[model samples]
Target: MAEEVPNSSNTVPIVGPEFARPQPSDLTIIGDTVKDTDGNKVFKVKTPLFGLHNKRILVDSNDSPIVTMKMKVTSKHDRWQVYRGSDLDDKIFTVKRPSTVQLKTRVEVFLKQNQTREVSCDFTIKGRFMKRACRIYVGDSTKIIAQVHEGDDRLVATIYPNVDSAFIVTLIFIFDLINMAGTGI
Candidate 1:
């Protein structure tokens, strides 16, 4: 079964029958994974790439920088440090994968104000990255914000109306990075 996530920060508007499906006029975009099936990753000069070094940034269409995702390289626990841009200020949130062993993808999200390491998560992502399927949810994992479906050539993300689509795209990009990193989370 597929998962559905609703945007908590934004309210979806009533859609007409004409806009039932995404149209060309819609603000939708496509992203491609830059690696081959054999696990060989390569980056071309002109092709847009996701740079994950000391600072990670996703270069979207027209070679424009969309979001900058920062993460710690030598951390004992898996965590997405920060996300720049969007109305949520420069500090979007932090994603930390639990240390407990599990087969599926489960991570806890903490908002910018959440400095203390509390057991409660502001949001959570649950799904399987190997299948290219995942869902982002609000606190307590009830309300969903976005979802990413796996495709043969690319990952398809259906972002809800009134939500920051680019933010969802960035999350998908980060998922690809962590999944491709061979961390086995």
Candidate 2:
């Protein structure tokens, strides 16, 4: 039988049994991030920009646009939305900071399919923007799907192979925005 545990709020029960972290071999991410200038940093993945927009895009090994991220200006939450393609309507998720008064950045992700403000988080990104560190978990579960750490000049992200690279990229971009906002730089 599967085990059912209550969530952080202790309101709704998490549906299924707990999941174990995937083995490193099971990870599909290339785990590469390189610098675009000076060659001081090494990136396992390549992020190349082609056009102009408030947002930026990153291409995969096939040169396909995998993730497009843009920040929203008018929202009180200071939101950033990540789409699967160039089209903003093809949204995968939105990351928003709680408010400006807090010290450590608190970001919540709401998937396009689950737009309810009251629903438990579809995925929660927890980390300190100042430290340039963060981890993305699968929904409310403790299973981490991706993570990022500070690098020489660039941020390094580790994405689980089974997860979408674009999704991971968006998470990293969200953290970058938080770092910029939190530091007031």
Candidate 3:
């Protein structure tokens, strides 16, 4: 028997319906290009070589900016904020570790509307970064929206239906940055 995917109604699509594949979609991220399982490029990551603050832009196949992720330099938990398109003021969501002293890699996401108090997370990411695997769940629940694991010289993300691929990719990007910082990379 095949495993069942979580119901799609439980989550919101960040980018749009077009990015929410009806079936589980696998994407490979190598360097800047994000390609589907069939090897067709779907998205691109634009990283600036030199900047006082680390920032990255996720662009679609047409080179249109989907989201911009930038790290908060003063955040003890290594927080990152994602904004819609290339406009930094149009913040969409934020991702940060639950605690700065955790032994394992764990992150929590909050939509822009929920950032004021942040009493609860909109989503949670838990896994072992050294193992190169993680699962993104809805809030603190077990309803997984996506899973990511390391691939040969790249990372592979499997996003379930109704979940935005760009959102998942942005979370994964933040996850990578957090772990890289931990290793002094």
Candidate 4:
């Protein structure tokens, strides 16, 4: 089953009618013992869309909720946004027709480059791994927390640079944090 979030912060709306695939953050974990037909452990990663959802996020159309190794290799910094949507802050939002399963997926842009993402029906606490991040530095994600901009892209990281005053992102997964001074949430 899918959940509809009127809370703006929790949900994202897609453009097409055939948006039937379950989204990222919605990926499920069958079990530590769950295996694919080949007997390899099947750990599913929730996928996110490209373009923007409402005013907070931008989902890359090329980056689908289900990304396989077979897909194109993104060798560059594909742009992502959090304060604007596809319409560029336009209010003409088209909502999906609603379904039995929630298809909204949250895409995490890893700080490190070249980490493979998978598509599955699993929704794990990868987010919980991020709970304390935004607050520490209040960068791009801060814009999200402040209702400024929003996007589904997340860069996986650890508290590396709370170094002296601010967290210095020191890894390949480093995300560009755009902080608009003074909106002080």
Candidates' TM-scores?
0.64, 0.65, 0.91, 0.17
lDDT of residue 63 for candidate 3: 93
Between candidates 3 and 4, the lDDT winner: 3
Candidate 1, 1-185: lDDT as tens digits: 45454434455321112222232112222344233234433211122255544455544434444455666677655677665532224665676777646588777767667737656887667787467677777666467766767666555555555555455555565565565563321
Worst 10 residues of 3 by lDDT: 1-10
Writing each residue's lDDT as its tens digit, candidate 3 over 1-185 gives 44345885644587666678767789998877889988998898888677745788889999999999888888998888899998989999999998988778999999999999999999999988577678898888877889988878888898987788989988887887787673321
Model 4 spans > 4 angstroms off: 1-27, 31-66, 70-139, 142-185
Backbone clash pairs for candidate 1 read: 5-144, 5-145, 6-144, 6-145
Candidate 2 wrong stretches, greater than 4 Å? 1-53, 116-118, 182-185
How do the candidates rank by TM-score, highest first? 3, 2, 1, 4
TM-score of model 2 vs. true structure: 0.65
Question: Looking at candidate 4, what is the lDDT of residue 3?
Answer: 28
Backbone clash count for every predicted candidate, in the order shown: 4, 10, 0, 34
Q: Can you give the lDDT of residue 81 in candidate 2?
A: 75
Candidate 4 residues 58-125, lDDT tens each?
22223222111111123222222211132333222111111222233122332211223322211111
Worst 10 residues of 2 by lDDT: 11-20
Model 4: per-residue Cα lDDT at residue 68: 18
Q: Residue-wise lDDT of candidate 2 within 2-31, one digit each (tens)?
A: 422323332211211111223221222223
**Top candidate by lDDT:** 3
Clashing residue pairs in candidate 3 (N, C-alpha, C atoms within 3 angstroms): none
Deviation in angstroms for 30 in model 2?
14
| True-structure lDDT of candidate 1 | 0.53
Best-first order by lDDT: 3, 2, 1, 4
